[model samples]
Target: MDLDHTGVSADELRRLLRELSGDLLSRRRFVRTYVEMWPTRLSRLVAAIDDDDLDETKVVLLSIRSSSVMLGVTGLAHLATQGLHALERHDLIECRHVRDLLAESGDRACERLLELEATESMLGR
Candidate 1:
């Protein structure tokens, strides 16, 4: 939230988050769900890049960045922000931070998923 550069409304953002939380825990709960969604969304972002869909790619990246911030993955958020900036500027991008973060997140998520997947695989033996 680049308040210094971009004039984003603090009140409006608070209101938006407030409005979204319902039927259970709170807005904070939804942030967790958002965090879980990030890894999967990266796949679509990469696909859009491969397809040369710059506009959609940019939009997706920006949304992913925002999700990263809202979800409190600071490293992930930095990566996403770097990617978004590169796409926005239409310049050659070598976001090592973003690459590394994505790799770390994917590796971590895959490890967890595989562990769970194997739990069933080894069950009842």
Candidate 2:
């Protein structure tokens, strides 16, 4: 449950499970879906920034930030927020840096989530 290095909060994940009626199946499914979509989301985000599509970048960033917060992916949420701020300031350079960080963080988060899911399954949680 010490998932600090993963940038995910176990307590927050539990809170989300509770909010989802405490359904273990639902929790697993949600985690799976989030992990599965991360690559595409990251791609779109990078593409938007590369294209200099400010509106698309904002949309993608907000989407990432909101969903990350909901799923307790605190690191990703924080990075997305920073990306938003950079966008707001018209700092494309900073936004690019954040995008790189996001890629790394997103990969780590997905790996951790998958490990957590496997652990939960093995323990029948």
User: Per-residue lDDT of 2-119 in model 2, one digit per residue for the tens?
Assistant: 2232487666677877797768788888888888889888999999999999999999999888988887788888889999999999999999988988886788987876676667
Candidate 1 lDDT over 30-107, as tens digits, reads 444654675667777777776767777777778766765553344455666777777667643453335445655644
lDDT for residue 76 in candidate 1, whole number 0-100: 52
Error of 2 at 99 (Å): 0.4
Per-prediction CA RMSD (Å): 11.2, 3.6
User: Which residue pairs collide in model 1, if any?
Assistant: none
Sliding window of 10 residues with minimal summed lDDT for model 2: 1-10
Q: 19 in model 1: Cα distance from truth in Å? A: 9.8
TM-score of each: 0.55, 0.88
Residue 106 lDDT, candidate 1, scale 0-100: 49
